[model samples]
Target: MNFIKTPTLLKNKSLSLLITARVSSNFAYQMLTVAIGWQMYSLTHSAFYLGLIGLVQFLPMLVLSLFVGHISDRYDRRKIVSISQLVQGICIALLAFGNYNGWITKESFLIMVFFIALAHSFEGPPMQALLPNIVERKIFPKASALVSSASQFAVIVGPGFAGILYSFGASLIYSITAGLLILASVLIIQIHVNKEERKPDPVNLKSFFAGITFIKSRPIILGAISLDLFAVLFGGATALLPIYASSILKIGSFGLGVLRSAPAVGALLMSALLTRKPLKRNVGKIMFTAVVCFGLSTIIFAISKSVIVSFLALFVLGASDVISVVIRSTLVQLETPDNMRGRVSSVNMIFIGTSNQLGEFESGITASLLGTVPAALLGGVGTILVVLIWRKLFSSLFTVDSFEGSKN
Candidate 1:
């Protein structure tokens, strides 16, 4: 269990392959997200349509995350991930085709998004489950950090590059993204995971219910995951960035790229900061403070009209958010037993993924109903409230000893 002693994960050829594949896929996916938002907004000039795009992506993830988590635990994670990537590649190619043919309609593009979400529903849980097996458990923290950092780095690179390509045209961006997916799938074929054999759970309604039941039984994990869900669901402002770029900030696609990349920059920097010396004592307290700061930054961001001020706010928000991410991921990995990492990660995905995609949808809907400023401001307020409520309701689970003391 002293997995840190082994430098194998960092030095292992297979691990290197997996990391490369993940990074490439993530870069393309991040590019696609910003490209889609810009495309939709340019086509319709409405926040509701923006919300609809989020909804299209979120609905499948919400509906299928649990089942996919179960499948990941029960079957071949490598195959699952590879197949999902293949499907996603096809979906992106179709979008590219439509764009090239000048036959793209909003409804048709949204349907493509729906298929992409479906592929993601299967893709995420299995990919996360595959990680613990690829590296030793002791190295899990660093591995997770590297993975998170790699993905965020993609965010930094992808949208920034995409904005420039987007100027050339949406079709070009789609073509590039599709090419990345194909490359990712090829890389996945080179990596391997040792699948755990388990007896199939009963194929019935009870099995589905059991997944939720197991999650409810773990208060620390449940509390941490739920607190994040509520806090993020209410406060995430990513969905409204398009509006901010065009109308409020009076900036173009380049400004939009900077705005989108801001959080990833903060997160990447924090990840590097933590790697120098990992988070030790009072992790729970740190996580709480981070969430509070995330809310505060969002509030500040909502009120800021200046691009420079908003970027600063986003940086803080990203920094705070990554603190919580590292803590929460560590907590889940430490607390969950080995037999159930996939299921647990899948369950975790339900909270985390939904909070992100659905949170985007919520922001979009609220922005459509209320004005964008009010919508964002209200989310910030709600995030603060969630933190306070979680502190009270789950007080006991939110504290941690210093890393040295706990390790003993």
Candidate 2:
């Protein structure tokens, strides 16, 4: 909370508005995820369907990443984001209507999320590209920290908020999320930034592929990006949390909410610490170390039968993940030029999108085959293996000592 009040950051009205808008939308998105996961699980009682939700969301992300990036670069980034949020809010409201009337079949539920994903794909890239322009270079790190903390705050409470509302009804959760998202849209539309209108690249094959080419040319960026993709692809234990809450932990929806939020609690705390004492050295090493810690924490969570132990492991995993996230994100932003930011962010989004949505599919398939516990265990072991392989292959990324280190 205190982090939001940092004097340098709040001086910019646009930054302030953007952060607040992001907080509202992110909170809605998090709560929406909880609602979707739980509602689908409750109705179908199938891990496969739960995973299907991720696939549905991923399709738009995969198909539209390039176009979204190009559009972000060409258009008013703030406008792109505002419209995206509005679209999602409208779809969520529809979801609420369908849900309240008991008309949302599993198939319908899947379709709704697909539309939400379409809006989401549009939202992520431009929103990311806009931040750098809204504030000074020197204050970007602090700004980024505050943004991350806002997201972490949403993470910490969003699911829990959903859970409490869910006790009233699933429709209540969707309805509230819809209202929040619409509020976010309205708030953000009023923001103003200092970016100059540049003549964007032409619409051609080369323009479409620019982001890919830039990332491929930088080993550090390539390694950092790829490492996150594969690691999360293998280690997306969160996808199976509903099953854990219902089958293993014998918990109700409220308890599931707590488990869902445990990692974010750790993430929020660690983000605050890093904000106060920004990383000054061993930057790359710390990122790798954090990844390793994340993997180990997953393992601990996988093995733990007790609720408290599982919660603690998830907390540590979330904490460790933020360290890697802050480093990788800073590296990506600082290294790339402003004009290229939108495209590069999109490329990053694709990897992140794949790792998350596809990872859910993988988790579901594996859980079905291996059982929930074994699926989780295998993911933890697999994450460690990725770190081991990535550390050797991406040695340049591993050894770098600063956020602005050479891309070579």
Candidate 2, residues 67-168, lDDT tens digits: the string is: 899888888888898899999999999999998898998888998999999888998888888888888876666678777877888888998888788889
| Candidate that scores best on lDDT | 2
Question: Which tens-of-lDDT digit does each residue in 15-124 have in candidate 1?
Answer: 77887888889888888988999989998999989988878887887888778877766777778888898889888989988998998888887888899888978887
Task: Give the clashing residue pairs of candidate 2, or none.
Answer: none
Ten residues in sequence with the least summed lDDT for candidate 2: 399-408
Give lDDT per model, in order.
Answer: 0.82, 0.86
TM-score, candidate 1, is: 0.94
**Each model's number of backbone clashes?**
0, 0
Identify the leading candidate in terms of TM-score.
2
Task: Pick out the ten consecutive residues of candidate 1 with the lowest summed lDDT.
Answer: 399-408
lDDT, candidate 1, residue 18? 82
